[model samples]
Target: MEVTIIEDQFILKTKVFFNNQSLQYLKKITGSRALIVSDSIMETLGYLQEVIDYLQESGITSTVFTGVRPDPDVSIIADGLKLYRESGADVLVAIGGGSAIDTAKGILYFERKFESTEGKEMPKPLFIAIPSTSGTGSEVTDFSVITSEGEKVVIIDEFIAPDIAILDSTCIQHVPQRVVADTGIDVLVHAIEAYVSTKATDFTDALCEKSIKLIFENLETFFKDSKNTQARDRVLNASCIAGMAFTNTGLGINHSLAHAFGGTFHISHGRSNALLLDAVIEFNANLGGSADGYAADRYAKLAEVLKLPARTRREGTVNFMLALKRLKKSLKVEDNIRSLGINQSEFEDALEQLAETALLDRCTPTNPRQPSKQDLIRIYQKCY
Candidate 1:
């Protein structure tokens, strides 16, 4: 194994300590005032009070910004940026899943460098992302995705990476099963895509492999029994690991399709990823030859890690489909895009736009196969 392959920098620098006790460490280093960005659901879940108490006990005041929504948009992030600037918060603490964390990232980014988006440097604020769910490892990565006019926009920079990530296992206790399923599948997609990505390196490959094994072994347990702390912890750790891997390696066609469709239709990102992942994987597999065979080998490795029956390329493809099928059934997730309330005409009309948007997405460049507009359309059609 080559320890030095290329000049690659994996800048997932967030210092994380799991379990509920990590809050004490967080309380110790936090400043006088921190902005806690979360959503209404999380606030109602009483996490806000718990965090506020922790802050107050440590003599650190906090300003709460609880307006974040699921699959957060640019407008929501802009609002968060305003709140962060007005509140004079020196530190930003995100206390939910991806939405809250993405919002916090955007807010902190805006505050540190560009007040008006006119003239600014490349860096931003020191952020702390504490995930309350077991997926969408926004806690660890410097990538933030926000929507604008039904298009997914991403901001990726090392400066946007959080200064700290506190993964309290207790946070995963009350997450709904649907969320677990959708985000868990997203985790799986991240791991698989990272392992096979053109940008994959030794560092990211290791993280991706470990994350795949963890998700394979524990995600079902989490879905079966939501209170299984050990399983939840494994899944949560895997989520962060996958995030680290994909942040460096980027994603593949699964993400490209998901971003395009979800952004256009207002569907959940994780669910969109889940629906398209298997289809994209199959499509990538059939393109044939050395590079394509390498992609198949990666999926075969993932299948073996998951203990699926994958000896040949065909078996590997079967394993991928079966595993995804089991996941969909276990989670009671629908298979088609139409089930998400997107009519046939809407999908057909948006097909060209989706193809264009996906082709232009940042993740598309890293895909093993650089698919064309026709390829994207065919992939989407297969998914439907």
Candidate 2:
């Protein structure tokens, strides 16, 4: 018997604060100046001013950069970097969804990269992430995806992970129902992908299992009643836990396809993932032509963990894929890219390029089943 020694190393460097009033913890950090990165909607919703008020109450001066946009691009990051450089802030705070946090990480990343190239030293700011949505988990992950020149560029490095993650369900209480459903499904995809990833270990598996169960139990309640405090908190925590797991285990073709498709169609990231998830699951579970059974076995294991009815591995795999589709339907997510209002002719024209981009995505390497461009294209077509 060849025994595989799986070295279990679980590292989570970010200090997490989870509670109803977790933003108050910012007062404990001894920084005199703070810079907040967010978007216009946050500003309009008064979240921006609320954070600024909190900093002021803590005796810290603050600057606001509200230029982040959906599917943020290099230019958005450059703008944020310029604001941070001029703010004279010792602490950086990101408030909003993944785009805001990703922009903040991008600013810090490029600043360090540029400084290193110039042989100059710059003090790193203390980074804090306050996610207003219960998805993406960008707050605790060593990853940031920024669009540039018609491509979604994924940046992964320990340096980009926030120093602290503050999870307060109150922040997400006002999120639109549609957004709630979209982001909630995103949490499920994160957990499922992390659980089945080739890099998954015992630690990540535990976190993924817990996260998945939480989403399944709480997402529907949270979506229907955003004011349900317990449901909101559970879903929020699940998002962060999933983020932590995927940061270590990495994601799969689902994320790769989402990134590419979102970049091309300008679709919301979470919604894009929701649309393609069922197709990707079926693709990963298929044991056709040189296919390894690792992913299929993992999917079956997940179904078992969820206590879905199954008599064997094949039944479990089928049940797992069906469960995902049923969940999407319950959440009111579209079943295909065509339903998302994408022009069929344009989608067909872009399929090859999208497939190529997905094949090169950073998340693709850790996927249990490696996919070729043609394989990715076929998946895209099926989803279409």
Candidate 3:
């Protein structure tokens, strides 16, 4: 049992906050010239005022950029970059879910480039990502997903990773039930995928396993009663842990397939993850080779976490699919990619293009079981 796992190295520079009050300290530490990048939904949730008041209390100067949209596009990043330039922001504070954080990271990346070009060589803009929803782990990872011409492109660089991650349960208190459900699916996928990732190391594997257990135990509670503080805390922490895990261990078919679906159909990332997760798990289980046994064993562990029987490989495979079915039903999630408003004609129209784009996605090669072009198309068909 003392197997030495490979060490995956990444800069975990982000500090964390438990309660919302830590915003004051953040502003004080950063000397108050912060630009807040948030989405319309968060602005409506009164987080905007809460953040502003905290900043004002600390005598911090802040500007707001509320233009981020769901599944942020590259154009949004450009907009944020413009704001970052014009405002001369010293810190980039992100106060929402993955979308806001991803958008902010992209903006910060470009902001540094612009700043460096002007000979004003400032340190990379510091970012604090406060996740209002418990998914995507964008708060901690150096990875940012941006859409470009209907393709999900992942930007990875240490400079783009957030400097701090603030997890406040109160921020998630008013989130809709559907968001919690959908995002929980992403959390689960992150942990499972990281567990079996080809890049998995001891540090990431530990985080992934812990994340899987926490998500498995508390997701239902958080969904059933959104106000359950303990459940919400567990869920949010699990999401962050999974984020750190996958950032180093990386993701596999689940994310590649999700990115493909997200880019083509404009479905939310979590929903995309949910739709393709089981299918990819099944596909991977049947894949046999040098690493196949190790992969299958990890999948079996995942099955056990889901309370599915894992007595044998065959049983574990069956349980994985059945568990996904039960999970979708429990979460009131729909099957059929068509439900995402993607017509059959549209999918048929984009099959070849989707296959090509998915092959190019950053998350593809790190898959525990690599899929061929035909396999990718088949997976798409299965999800479809």
Most TM-score-accurate candidate: 2
Q: Can you tell me which runs of candidate 2 are displaced by over 4 Å?
A: 1-8, 287-292
What is the TM-score of candidate 3? 0.91
Pairs in steric clash, model 2? none
- Tens-place lDDT per residue, model 2, 97-202, is 9999999999999999999999998788899999999999999999999988978999999999999999988899999989999899889999999998988999
lDDT of 3 by residue, 1-384 (tens): 799996547546677676544545554555557799998888888887788777776677789999998878889999888888888777788999888998998897777778789987757666778898999888989899888876788888888888888888878878788888889999988988888888887788788878988877888888889889889888999999999988887788788878877777778888888888767877887743332466787887767766789897667767766866776778888787877777898898787777777777788888877888788888888888
Model 1, range 1-384, lDDT digits (tens) per residue?
Answer: 769677667666878877655766665765777788988777888877788888787777888999898777778888888888787776778999888898888776666557446665533444778888777888888788887776788778777788888888777778888889888988988888888898898899889989988887798899889889889889999999999888888888888889889888877888999889767887777633442476777777777767788878668766866887886777888888777777898799999999998888888888877789999998899788
Query: Candidate 1, TM-score vs. the true structure?
Result: 0.92
lDDT pick, better of 1 and 2: 2
lDDT of 2: 0.90
The lDDT per prediction is 0.81, 0.90, 0.81
Give the TM-score of each candidate: 0.92, 0.96, 0.91
Every model's Cα RMSD, please?
3.2, 2.7, 3.7
